[model samples]
Target: MRNMRLAAALALVFILVTTVFLGGCGQKLAVAPQQGGLQGLKKLKVGLVFDVGGRGDKSFNDAAYEGLEKAEKEFGDKIEIKYLEPSAGGENRERLLRLMAQDKYDLIFGVGFIFTDSIAKVAKEFPQIKFGLIDGFVPGLKAENNISCLLFREHEGSFLVGAAAAMQSKTGKIGFVGGMQSPLIEKFETGYIAGAKYINPNIGILSDYIGTASDAFKDPVKGKELTLKQIKDGADVIYHASGASGIGVLEAAASQQKFVIGVDSDQSLPAKEDQRSFVLTSMLKRVDVAVYETIRSLVTQKFQGGYQEFGVQENGVGYAENQYNKELIAANKAKLDELKEKIIMGEIKVPTSKEDLK
Candidate 1:
């Protein structure tokens, strides 16, 4: 981590990447409606930096963008917005954040856990500026009072979908695919296994990860390969916490007409018509709500530093029940909600780590 920081510092000197702007309301990640001019009709100035896969991932990044879009509509001409995506390998996150600080944006947002180190470093230098971090955390970030660590109880939502997968599986076996194989994604895996076991104590679960690095989220080809392997192993239903990579999982499952669960956003909503039927349900992580509320807090002068957590109790995480998956989910909805209530009531403990799952 220290080596990366040194490299980033040097990049800011000999190889800077912070000046790439595309010209728009939110030039970095989006184009907001023009309020006459960038200087005219501005209230709060906001900036956002997307994670590696950028805006079209239709998963984590897309969910965060939804919140930014909502804030733009409600705030109207009263707010100014700008967003940026990192370099191809996501190596310039710190520089982009530092540039935003230099630009004096009122509130800056780093939209994934990958930004924890970058945001924490930058927020300290610009102590007066506020930052919102989705799915990121730092040891002393709370005390800084300039950065909001927006966290989600991802395991809670994952558990619900896991239960759904177990209940719907006819093969008595299921599978889980994760992106980047980190402790964060482990929450998805652990909760999934727990929920599946809760439904059937002896149910077999086959799991795999796209990779150990950030590229894992973008590797759809590898995602498909892993999904197919799981299916061949007798696992009928599958769930994925992968970002864009899960698109391959969805496609692979549909090829065999097996059930699959999605994460972050509703995969079925944007899925191709032919592949849409295979997506059983998605674990709604509610990244949009978190982003919108953080923005709202700033507007309402209620913004505070610390870990801002959202979970099942906060309605920040759950399972999706939409037109495509309504019938399938309805068959198991009653028990799923019962498990949800148990989670919220603290009656059933959902584990976030492999050790805890045991």
Candidate 2:
């Protein structure tokens, strides 16, 4: 009886530990179910932490999710992947990143520029692990082939859509809605302005922002309000880099029957069907491509540290010409391609900052 009781206690302890690790304790880890397991094979473990607006933002974060999904699809047999979403404001981003590093994930990804500092800290602590930072990095900080800064030439892509907006706008007055007030966001804003002015030097462009914080990307109500104000002020076209908040810009466009451009992703698909017609071309930043390439490099043992840029020349950025806005793009495709060639060939330089625009 004593022997049997001891065995039962051990079994119970094992069960409890298993349950907690498998998330029976109420925290669900979206771990991909393994198939055809190699009993002795070592699988690369990967973790990704989302930026503000999380997975369903249908903008930047969603694009990152696509890259994760692609990596899983391509390397499911060789790798295991999991992701976590931060609280609404992303206040605990560093905490979450550090927790993942503490768990010893082999490869981790920080989905936005907000993760620059957090990933830098965690990457340094876990020198053996590789970290991929999207759109952010620690300047001059090297982690011995551990940190890969995945930067994008977002300004070039934004310029394409900005020029498209100028060519198609009926009122000759377009607008821009940015998520936050940062040099990064200014990349989109200044690029858009320069692109528009490149085509129509005398054009009028109205620019507004959702807020001054990360939460700015989550506020669609404010996006709609600002968009409406721009519309009322006689702007006939709008483009937004406000992440989830861009949904409001879409709504405002639908209500007012005005055309709007989208950012990050090919957002025309997610727009309300009725509102889809009014969506102009989108500036495609290829965040999904960047994410996928990072994962691929790691899995293929080609991973290296330092900065990597995704720009038009790299096919890492461009404009979306889809069925929803094929007509507009078709009309401007010639000029758009010309300007794109110029940027790629060094004939026309796109401004990445406001000061450079002059």
Candidate 3:
């Protein structure tokens, strides 16, 4: 009886060990690979959320999408891309965050300053998930180990446009149409005015901040009305940094037979083939470049979480070469070329803020 009892005890121990081993093996098989070595066997899922303007604006959101598309092409089986376009005042911010968390996305990116608050809250709730935020800063909010903040020196690019506008304007008067009166929008205005003055101190600037922070960039009717008034004020060239609302500014410029400067992307391309005459130039923000670089960094395990700013020094922002303007202003092209070289060479600094204006 003692021998039989000992044998049973040994048998039970063996069975328990086998069961634990098999269970552990199964769990290991279920867990996805966490590093780049298994990229071929598994895909890294990524999600993006666009702000109120959404896609088809041919500007900010579209530029970000371009980067995401590039990643899909380059990473192949290594990545899967997903996106969300929030409707006006969309409450899906938290919903999207929850979806990303539940779906086990490897990384998620949020576009626009408006989503800063949402990102902050989501980042806190999911400490294990990684995130990227564009165009805004949250102070004292400790982004988890997996979060990164990307910012652009829009003022730097805007300054160059301002200088170009002042130099190219047949009319001494120039105007600015900003979508919102927030600090971000003001950055564009401050840099532009400073750049204009740098070129010609006497240039008359007609500036108007269309609406308060919340409503400023969304009101197309106000954009058109403000732009029309600027045209009537004898401003032949106007710079618009008003998101989708800038479309109205472009239309107004076309109707008035005046030149308009575009923001974020190559707006000149969006203008009708015949209406191309109205777009003098566009400020290239290179949001696509930033997004692409960030993704590449993650793939390479070079992800640095904090703040990064892109500027002319990094070739991250500038003005598109005005192919049309070059032909029209053939005689003046040399001056523009000289100015570009000077700015690039650091001989001439382009002012991009109110402090830089003087």
Candidate 4:
């Protein structure tokens, strides 16, 4: 009987140990790749090069990071991912693209329009490598049938912010500060002005562009100066499509105790708690979602080339729902929601280019 009891205890110990081990194994298997899916797709290497703002802007760059993170999580062991931050004067873009091509990455994504010329040039040289360009396009550039372009309907989101600004403004005057006067930046400004006019034709707008694309988006000092000037000119609300330079606009707004709208992402989250008071809302452009979706298509062998647009119709861009400032006028929210539904239902069409504006 003693021998039997000892044997039983040993058996119980073995069972408990096996159960623990198996439980852990099960957890690992849950996340493990399936027999023939993306799990089996090995030797996959991907690289992403960010545009001028780099990662900390908490707007465009951050969104792109989120998409890359999603790709990392889903692809797991089958893929290796890397990112490059370009320096001033676009010095790093060509070097990094060349390095990525030399490294034989399976896919490379260039994050902004600044890379249009570089990518167009590099893609032609590295014909066998697959490339994804975001926010810009390279016409007549062919890369071994492996290049794709991703564009966004930024004007669509800008329109929403314009409406929001118009409804929320205590003063009828508003301002738009663009990083550069490119056709792309004008898309945002034109859509915004149209939206404001849609609400009230008499709404006054002060618009200015910061000069060159590279300098326009990074000059916080200039952004601040322009924003203050607008405020003094009777503009109570301001919208900035100026990338990192928009930081100055937000700072100026906070200093002046005025309201400011953001672009690309929810700036309130990144702003200091005190500064957040002036951030009324953000025009959220899900560039990250676009990046992730494009990568996902490649992972799943569903990559589609040509132009892809993200808009309110695709849930790609919109205004933040006043999470930080719950005290927004109820009527304003209601009106915005009504307009959103109309836009979604085809009763209202948001402009895509400046030419679309009436």
Per-residue C-alpha lDDT of model 2 across residues 240-318, encoded as one tens digit per residue:
9999999999999889999999989999988779988998878888989988998898888888788999999998889
| Model 3 per-residue lDDT tens digits across residues 1-358 | 9999999999999999999999998787667444333544777788888776778776788888888899889986677889997757655766776688778887888888777888888877887777888887877534336678788888778878888889889889999998767878778888788778878999999998777764455667888999999999999999998877888888899899998998898888877876678888888888888788888877776877777788877878888766665564455457656766776688876555566565
How many clashes would you count in candidate 3? Answer: 1
Off by over 4 Å in 2: 1-40, 141-143
Q: Give the local distance difference test score of model 1.
A: 0.89
lDDT per model vs. reference: 0.89, 0.89, 0.80, 0.83
For model 1, residues 246-265, the per-residue Cα lDDT tens digits are 98999899999998899999
Score every model by TM-score: 0.87, 0.88, 0.84, 0.85
Q: Clashes in model 4: which pairs?
A: none
Looking at model 1, the pairs that clash are 28-83, 28-84, 29-83
Candidate 2 residue-wise lDDT at 220: 96
Model 3 Cα displacement at 260 (Å)? 0.5
Cα lDDT of candidate 4 equals 0.83
Candidate 3: list runs displaced more than 4 Å: 1-40, 140-144, 328-352, 355-358
